[model samples]
Target chain A: MQTHSYTSRRELETYHFHPMVAALVPLAFLLLQAFLPKIFPRLLILDLPLVAVIFFAVARRSPIAGTITGTVIGLLQDALTHQPIGVNGIAKAIIGYAASSIGVQVDVENLTTRILMNFVLSWVQSLLLFLIFRYLLGLRDTHLVWLHELVRASLNTAVAIPVFLLLDRVKLRE
Target chain B: MESFFSRFKNQLVLIVILLVQTIALAVQVRRPVEPGHPDAESVRLLRYWASSLMTPAERISTGFGHSVRGGWSSYVGLRNVRAENEALKKQIAEMRLQQAAISEDALEGQRLQKLLDFREHYVASTIAAQVIGTSGSEQSRMLTLNKGYEDGLKTDMAVITPDGIVGKLRLVFPHSSELLLVNDPTSGAGVILESTRIRAILHGSANGRVQITNLTQDSRIKPGEKVITSGGDQVFPRGLAVGVIESIVPDPEHQPYTLITLKPAANLFQLEEVLVITGTQPNLPGDAQQQLAADAEKHAADVSAERLPSIHDGPATEADPSKPTDETAPPANNSTDLVPKPKPALHPDRYSPGTAAPAAELTPGSPRPATDAPAVEPVRKTPVAPETPKEP
Candidate 1:
């Protein structure tokens, strides 16, 4: 595992992305996330924006760029909802920064790593939303449905594997 | 100092971004956009920007999808067409029968209302809007309509379908608007159980289920009983179908009220189009009201004589105390004769439209009113005055 991590890290040091791809990919994911649910309601369980954020952050491998990208994408996602814009923004920003920082040390390109990353990040997002809602906004409307969320996390991971593979082609590598 | 600043710059950026968002959230929560207020206009402007950017794409996509689906269904889906058409015909026949019965009842209700001088409010004009998109989040349940301020839609206007109410228009943009669905956690409506007519507040839960709250535990509400808008909220018109009670359970909080789950009459999840009520008019009395009044007058004229005090056929002011009480009886002087006068036929002019004469004057022996006297002939036989016996 250590040897594999060193090799992927060395590869990451050389990896880079086109700026337009960085911008448009996240926007496309946001649009799809918003649009697909209207066609098939069951698709509501999949958080495509979060998947895009994780993919971008890990691919960029720069904490600062990942944080900024997450913030912009999160706010855009917020714009599509009726919720307070910042809740998703804050959560995604944290996820983006952490994923990129960890990406520097691990091989998130592995399918298993990608799934585990999404699974853990989904819970983290929900927890942060709960805290912000309870402490900052004094809202109690969102309940912690552990089982539903677990299923949602697994679905997000499953979707991420294929979506990331498609996105990888569009990504420009050094 | 320079090394320290460089080292913490990324962390500082994250902190700054988070702080800015936090403030934005706080500001939004502090003065949330409400319908009709000028302060809320700012929020509408923001929504307008967002919707203008998004809804055009949505419309194009939906239109394209519909065309594609339509083409496929028209040619490739012909196998069940005949069976479906026959089923639809049968359904139409059944609905026509129901419509006839309902129209009869509505006529009767209108007649009764007119008799009591009751006024009603009815939808005067409405604009049809297509459901283009949703709020795209579970936290807020809302839909976007294809009509907006240009279409004369304002905030707080009622939106409904033939089956039931959808919701109220919340935010209006130039070309589109947002509707807060009735099942959102923040939504509440004054609803009445159709069976018992007991009123309660219909509240939306976070899980997208709606329930009746504030009904006393003793209230007998049956499952499958319909719920309707009470017009108490002044948002939806009264008597519009809302939903049906699905179940009644004790309040989990041990409160005095029971909780009732409801199945919405409108297919909230599958809405395609809705009617936005633009204006309402006061319902004026129709022919039904006039017919009711005429019938009442006729009834009163028929029974007036039996209900009034009897008087001799003379001027109403000058009463003869010795006169027999019954209109048919002859004068008292004819005690030996004991013969009664012939009863008069009912006068045709006795009861005219809008005129209700005093009951005593309507009797057979009484002279008709001067205006009607020329048209009425006295039909009763005047008894012959008893021949004087004084000479004998």
Candidate 2:
């Protein structure tokens, strides 16, 4: 078995990313978040995208690519939201990089590890986004977005094991 | 040498891309999809082209997509279509109910306009122009329109809507023009109570009602009294319906005038269109002469300015370069923002400085506002509440 480590930018770029799949789930999360309030009426600030972002960073193991993904998603989010430009972008980038760094440093290559990592990381991401948007950016609309993020993160963590197994095709790989 | 060539090649590509994007963006910005934007011509052209080119498959897909969700909704929405149809039928009935009322309103508006037109038609040779754009500012309500010198619009010419007087012409361009709405803080209308014949000054307000002030307490003022432009100055024809006097009250200073409140007939927001009455028909020959002079003035202004509109809507003012201009008609000094949008079919050659955006010049008629209301009154007036005396 070749114990290969991806260090070059080209190697990273050329790698089998399945960009559509990687980007699609977060977009689905965004769509769900948008429609959920209309359908459910009671659901507010469900941070499904935040959870999906964390999953990309940890499971995908690509900080740079994750940051790029975050930027595009951030732009889309900004279009949907009234927040100032670059606020969401910076928050998303920080979340992506932080999650990627954690995955690299730790020996978290299993289902349980992925789930736990997603749970913890999503909370951190939510806090940072709230802090930046609320305190730094001076947009204190409601405490709901952060709260919904926490609930969504937990929900995401619960499904992490099954989703990772499916996405990574771990069972087939073995 | 090789490195330099490669660098130049990359730089050239970047520059080319930037240049193309800039041109595209400028065109796109000039004619936004919205009404009052300058690029309405483009929007119309695009819509026409798109409508013609749309494939049968695409139309099918769109129709299918809409009905699919309705058909498969969790409740089996198709099953409830009959009840849904009933609700829609009820709505249709209400709409039918309102249709007569609306048509009556339209008829009234037409009559009012015709009356004003009959009077104005003989004045400055008025060209009927539509109000195409409105400045978004609440304090200085200005309207940009699609007619100007090309359409025989001139400064000080009267503009009016179906409801009542809009405002006099302020600035003129070849293809577009700007009018100061009557509600601006700077706006003052010479008006009189049609019922009492007591002359009172009607002023516009922040909230959407006109207030008549400076009336003596001795003067009897009551609600439902008709107010009209006094026409003492002979500028506004007398007996034009301004609004009814809503109330009367005593002032602590014992000011003689009661605060008479009136509502304008025109719902400012609902007006997608307006008419510019440019004086009378006999004035047309003189109007043509003055238009020549204005064109000359614009030419001089263009020569002194650093640049002019990059694109041409039409060759309406192609000979303007030869016209003589007033050397002293000062070029607009160091404007903080960009020039008004390039007006096409409206003014074709007009430029409203600082009031309109680049996009306004290109679009003639904006779509009706997306809101249930067109605008919260294009002109906001405040109803002066009469301070009733407390009976002992």
Tell me the alpha-carbon RMSD of every candidate.
11.3, 30.0
Which one is best on lDDT? 1
What DockQ does candidate 1 score?
Answer: 0.54
lDDT, residue B315, candidate 2: 49
Model 1 in CAPRI terms: which quality? medium
Give me candidate 1's TM-score against the actual structure.
0.78
- Estimate how well candidate 2 is docked, as a DockQ score: 0.10
Question: Model 2: runs farther than 4 Å from truth?
Answer: A1-44, A60-76, A79-82, A107-111, A140-149, A158-161, A170-174, B1-65, B70-392
lDDT of 1 by residue, B17-61 (tens): 889989887887899454465234444455566677778887887
DockQ for every model comes to 0.54, 0.10
Model 2 per-residue lDDT tens digits across residues A15-59: 234657765676666555443433232343345565566666655
**Superposed Cα deviation of residue A94, candidate 2 (Å):** 1.9
Determine which window of 10 residues in candidate 2 chain B has minimal summed lDDT: B50-59
Error of 2 at B362 (Å): 58
Of the candidates shown, which would achieve the greatest DockQ relative to the real structure?
Answer: 1
Per-model TM values vs. the true structure: 0.78, 0.33
